[model samples]
Target: MPHADTLTVVHHDDTRTSYTDVRYQLHRDGIRIWSDEGEHALTDILMTHAYRQREARAS
Candidate 1:
């Protein structure tokens, strides 16, 4: 089992024939933080995390 506070990514391919129909869900402690079907979803999440970390260090 994953840790309670662990961030997890659940991915699904809506169409087996192509990679364009993809979905992503971001969860923490079994609760969803956000979900997106766009191709840039993972990149957006990663960048957001990086931005938060940088802000935390600056404070």
Candidate 2:
């Protein structure tokens, strides 16, 4: 896990029928979470949700 510090979550979202992506993402590992699906898998989810929330607050 080289440069793991730089390997941040980047973003998260709650796309499931339950809790938000942020809550779910941080549930197990907090920030440095891993999935067999790959890096972008979770990061993309968080990224979308983060942007959505940002826009919502702006409006």
Candidate 3:
């Protein structure tokens, strides 16, 4: 699992992307995900652990 403060990136399209925060609900009904663009259901957010990666930094 990602750390609470970690920023998540979602690809909305081939040329569009969104950064979001994903958290579990207090009641455990489901997860909550949101970004500057908007919010969406956990089920609506498609992701894969195998595809996740850390951002590279320049020296």
Best by TM-score: 3
lDDT of each: 0.27, 0.30, 0.37
Worst ten-residue run, lDDT, model 2? 50-59
What stretches of model 3 exceed 4 Å from their correct place? 1-27, 44-59
Task: List the candidates' TM-scores in order.
Answer: 0.17, 0.16, 0.28
Higher lDDT: candidate 2 or 3? 3
Ranking by TM-score: 3, 1, 2
RMSD of each: 11.9, 13.3, 8.4
- Supply every candidate's count of residue pairs whose N, Cα or C atoms clash at under 3 angstroms: 0, 7, 0
Tell me the tens digit of each residue's lDDT in model 2 across 1-59.
21221132333454432123222233333333433433333324343122123222211
Candidate 2 at 18: error in angstroms?
A: 8.4
The clash number for model 2 is 7
Candidate 1 backbone collisions, by pair: none
lDDT of candidate 1 over 1-59, digit per residue (tens): 11122233333432222222123244542222322333333322221111111112211
Clashing pairs in 2: 11-46, 11-47, 12-46, 12-47, 13-21, 13-46, 14-21
Give candidate 3's whole-model lDDT: 0.37
lDDT of 1: 0.27
